[model samples]
Target: MTVAVEFIVNQLKQVLLEEQVSTNETVRQLHGKDESHHALSLPDIVVFPRSTADVSAILKIAHVERVPVVPFGVGSSLEGNAIPIAHGISIDFSEMNAILEIRPDDLLVKVQPGVTRSQLNKELKKHGLQFTVDPGADATLGGMAATNASGTTAVRYGVMRDQVRDLEVVLSDGSVIHTGNLAAKSSSGYHLNGLFVGSEGTLGCFTELTLQVYGIPEFVTAGRAIFGTVADAVSAVTALLQAGIAIGRVELVDEDSIQQANIYNETAFAEKPTLFLEFHGNEAGMQEDIAFTEAIFEDFNCLSVEFEQDNAARNKLWEARHSLAYAYIHAYPGKKLMSTDVCVPISKLAETISYAREQLDIAELAGGIVGHVGDGNFHALLMLNPNDPQEQAKADHFNEQIVQYALLRGGTCTGEHGVGIGKMKYQSTEHGAALAAMKSIKTALDPYNIMNPGKIFT
Candidate 1:
C-alpha cells in the first residue's frame, strides 16, 4: 500500500529547513483555525516555507497534486481568513520572518511575509520611523495586507492597502512577480495591488512586501472625553472630525467596556461612555488642536475631558484601548467572542451605532461596542456561549440584524475583517452584480480553487 502525496512531501521536507511537510494530526491542528468565532478544521498537511522559492515550489507541487493550499500567519485573524477548511496543505510563513531592507532615504521598508507589525516597528524605532496600522494584535504584515486590516490609527494613516507600495507575490503556477513599484502612486497595469491587498490569499501568496512608513512625530498628547451617553461620545468624534483636527487616534469605547478594562487591566478608569483621543504635531500646533477639540467636545455635551501629556501616560491610555476585546474575554469565562464591524458615512454613524446598541439589548448579549469612530466605523462584540445552542442563536440573530441594517444604509458588512465564511452570506446583498465580477477574477486567478477554498465565496 502507498500514500499518494506523502512520499513527495517527505522528499520536499528533507531539504527545507523549517518545512513541517508532515501529515501529523498535531501539525494539522496547529494551522487549522485563527482567533475568530468560526469552528476549526484541520488540514491534512502543514508546510513552513522559508523563502519565495520555497513557497513557489510548494504551490507548484500542490497544484499538480490537486491539494489545496492555505497561508497561515500568527493565527491572530479576527475573521476565519487563516482557517484551512479544504484539508490539504497548510503553508505557515513564520519561518520567513525577516526585514529584507530598510530604505530610510525613501521612507519605505521591504520585508518578508512572516514579519509581524510590532517586530517591524521595534526595528524601525532606531531609524525614527513607524508603521501605523495597529490592529490590536501584533499580526504578521502579510496577514494584515491579506485582510486589508486597519485599526484606531487607520482613521488618520489609512489601512494596510494604503501603506503597501509594492508586493512580491508567488502565483499558483510558481511564477514570481511584482505588483507595483516604489513610486508614491502608480496608474500602471491592472491595479494588481488593489486586487491582492484584500484578496485573503485566494489569488497568490505574498513573499515580499514594500510598505510606506512615517517618521515619529515631534509631540504627542492623549486624552479621554467622557460622556453621559454613547450618542454624546459619538457626536464629539463627528464634530472633531468636521472641525478638521489633526488627530492621530480617535477610539469610541463604551462605559461597559471601560468597566471591563478596569477589571481586566487592573487600572482605574471611570465607567462612562468615553472617547480615547490623541493628537500628533509640534507642541504649539498640538496645543491649538487640543483646544479646538475640547471646545467641540464641550459643544457636544461632553461631561468631562482630561489630557495626559507625558509619553508614559499616553502609552497607558492607548494600551487600555487596545485591550478592549481581551477585556470581554476575561470578564466572561467559557464564552466565545464574536465581533461585527460596519463602516458608514460620517453622517450615518450615530444612527448606525444607536441601532446596534438596541440589537445588543434586544438579544440580551453581554458585550461592548468600540472601534475607530473617527472613520465612522464601529464594531459590536458579543460574548457568546459556543456550546449553548440557544445563546449561539441569539448572537447569530444579533449579527444578522446588525449587518442587514448596515447593508440597507449603504454600509459594508465588514469594514476590515475581510469576507471570510462569516461575512460570505452578505456578499450577494452587498455587492449584487459586482459579486459576479469578483467571482470571475477568483476563477481566472485560481481555476482549481486550491487556494483558500470555501472562503469569501465558494
Candidate 2:
C-alpha cells in the first residue's frame, strides 16, 4: 500500500468501527468500477459510513492526510462517477440506507444517500405516493442526485435536481450543511440545492437528501405506436409535444433495441421503430387526452397503435421500456457497455437521431438506440470488447459524432448523465468560458481537489 493510503487508513481506523473499514482485494475490486466501460482501478481501502456524523469524521481525516476520497452509492452509475481513480479510500454508503422521514401530507421524504429509487417507491406506495425519477438501474437517491439522473418519466416529472428539495452535504473540510429547507418553493439566496445535485461529488459528498414526491395518478394509460421509420416516429412525437399533449412518459425504442428487448424479456413486441407512451390524469380527463394523442400519431402515419388500459398491461409495457438498457447489456456477456446519452431541442430530434444512425453505420458498430423522446434525450448503447483497443476506438468515434451533432444544434452533451470521465473531453466545447466559472466554483469549494479527483475538469 502507498504511504498516503496507509496513513489515512490508520487514522480512520481509530474513529471508525472495525467492520466499517476494509482492504480485502474482493472489497476493493467491488468499489473500483461502476456500470460504465471504464477499466477498474481499485482503491487501497473501502469504508462504510452509517450516518452523517461518521461521514464527517471520514472526510476530516482524509482532508488532513491529503488522501483522495471517493463516495460510492451502489456503483450503478452509467458514467465513471463512482470510480475511485486516485487509489485512496472509497466510501460506500450502503450502510447508511435508511428512509429517515416520510411526510405524506407535504409530499416529501427524507432519505439517506444509500436508499435506492425502487426502495423509496415501494415505501411511498403505502402512502399512495411515489418518487417520479426512474433511471434504468435501481440507482441510489444520492447517486441519482449527483449525476442529475432522469428517465422515461422526466418528460413530465422532471429530473433528479427537480425533486431534491434539500441536501445535507459534507464538504472537503468536514463541515456539514443543508442546502435548503422543506418549503415547496424558495426564492432564497443562492440555489445551493441546484449546485450540489449534479456536482458529481466534486464539490462535496451528499449525506442526506429531502426529496419531492407525488401522489399516485388517479388514472393511467399506456400505448405502443410503431412507425415505418425513425423519422416518422420522431416527427409524430414532435407533433404531440407541439399540440400540448401532457404525456407522463414517451420512449423511443429502435428496431435493433426492440429485438434485444424481445430476446431478454421474452415478449413479442414488434421489431419496428416504436414509441412507448403513457398518460396520467383524472379518470374523466384521460379518455379525451388519449384520443387527441392518437390523432396526432395518425397525422404522422403511425403504422399501428396499441393501447393498454388495464393496470397489469400498462405496467408490463413500461417494464419492457425500463428493461431495455439491461437487455442490451445482457445480450453480450463479455463486452463492456459504453452507454452515451445526449439531448437536443424537440424540433431537432428527428435529424439528431438520424445522424446517430448514420454514424453507427459508418463506424460499423452494432449499437442500440433507446430514448425518452418526450424530451429530446436518448442513449446509444455500444458494446465494446474490452480486450480490443481498435473496437474501443470505434465506439469513441461514434460518441464524438453524436455529441458534435447535438452541440452544433444547441443541445447538451448529456441531459441526465452528468459529466463524468466519459464526457470530460466535450465539457470545454460544450460550456466554453462557463466551464472556467465552474472551475472557480470547484476551487473555492474543494480547494484540495481531493474529492473525486481526475473527474469533470481533468
Candidate 3:
C-alpha cells in the first residue's frame, strides 16, 4: 500500500472498530464495482460506518490526508456510481441499515443510508403505506436518491427526487447539514434537496434521508397488451396519456425482450411487442380506466389484451417485467450487460423508440428495448463480450448514437442512471454552460475532491 493510504487507514482504525476497517482483498473487491459493465477498480480499504458521527470521522481523516472517499450502499448502481475508481477508501453503509422513523400520519419516513427499498416497504405495509419509487432492484434509498432513480411507478408516483424530503449529509470537511425539512412544500432557501439527490455522491455523503410515502391504492389491476410493432405500442401510450387516463404503470417491451423473458421465466407469452400495464383507484374507477385502456389499445391495432385482477397473478405479471434485465444476463453467459436509457418528450417517444430499434438493428448487437413508456423513458439492454475490443467499440458507438439522438430531441443522455463514469463524456453536451456552474459548486463544497472523485464531471 502507498504510505499515504496506509497512514489514512491507520488513522481511520483509531476512530472505528478494527473489524469495521478492512483491507481484506475480498472485502475491497466487493466494494469496488457496481452492477455496471464498467471495469472493476478496487479501493485500498473498505470501512463500515454505523452512524453519522462515524461518517464524519472518516471524512475528516480523508479530507485532511487528501484521500479519496466513495460512499457505497448495496452496489446496485447501473453506471458504476459506487465504484471507487481512484482506489482510496470505500465507506460501505451496510452496517447503518436502519429505519430511523416512520410518521405515517405525515406521510414521511426517516431512514439511514443503508436501508433498501424493499426492506422499508415491508415495514410500511403494516401502516397501509408504500414508498413509490420502484427501480426494479431492491436498491438502497441512499443510492437511489444519489441517482434520482425511477421505474415503472414513476409515471404515477414520481421519481426518487420527488420522494426525498430531506437529507442529512456530511461534507468533505467533516461538517454535517440537512438539505431540507419535513414540510410538504416550501419556497424557502435553495433547492438543496434537488441538488443533493442527483449529485451522485460528488458533493457530499448522505447519512440519513427523510422521504415521502403514499398509502396503498384502494384497488389495483395489472394487464398486458400485445401489438404488431413497437411503434404501435408506443403510440398507444401517447394516446392514453393525451386522453387523461390515470395509469399506475405502463411499460413497453419489444419482441426480443419478450422472447428472452419467455425462455428465462418459462412463460408462454407471445413473442411480440407488448405493453405491460397497471391501474390504481377505487374498484369502480379502476374498472372504468381498464375499459378505457383496452379500447385505446384496440384502436392502436393491439392484437390482444389480458388483465390479471388476482393479487398473485398481478404480482407474477409485474415480476416478469422487473426480471427482464436478469433474463438478458442469464441468456448471455459470457457477456456483460450494458444498459443505457434516455428520456424524450411524450410526443417524440414513438419516433425516438423507432430510431433506437433501427440503430440497434444496424449495429448488429445482441440487445433488447424496454421502457417505462408512460413517462417517455426507455432502456436498451445490450450484451457485449467485455474481452472483445471490437464488440465493445460497437456497443460504445451504439450508445453514443442513442444519446445524441435524445439530446437533439430535447431529452437527457441519461434518464435515471446518474452521470457515473459511463455517462461522464456526455455531460458537457447535455448541460453545456450549466456544467460550469456545477463544477463551481463541487469545488466550493468539496475543495479537496475527496468525495467520489472522477464522477459526474470527467
Provide the RMSD of all predictions against the true structure, rounded to 1 decimal: 1.5, 1.1, 0.8
Candidate lDDT values, in order: 0.88, 0.90, 0.93
Top model by lDDT, which number?
A: 3
TM-score of every model versus the real structure: 0.97, 0.98, 0.99
Local lDDT at 433 for model 1: 99
Residue range 139-227, candidate 3, lDDT tens digits: 99999999999999999999999998999999999999999999999999999999999899899999999999999999998989999
lDDT of 1 at 278: 87
Clashing pairs in 3: none
Candidate 3: worst-modelled 10 consecutive residues by lDDT: 1-10
TM-score of 2: 0.98
Q: For every model in order, what is the number of clashing pairs?
A: 0, 0, 0
Q: 407 in model 3: Cα distance from truth in Å?
A: 0.3
Q: Specify the poorest-scoring 10-residue window by lDDT in model 2.
A: 1-10
Q: In angstroms, what RMSD does candidate 1 have relative to the true structure?
A: 1.5
lDDT, candidate 2, equals: 0.90
The numbered model that scores best in TM-score is 3
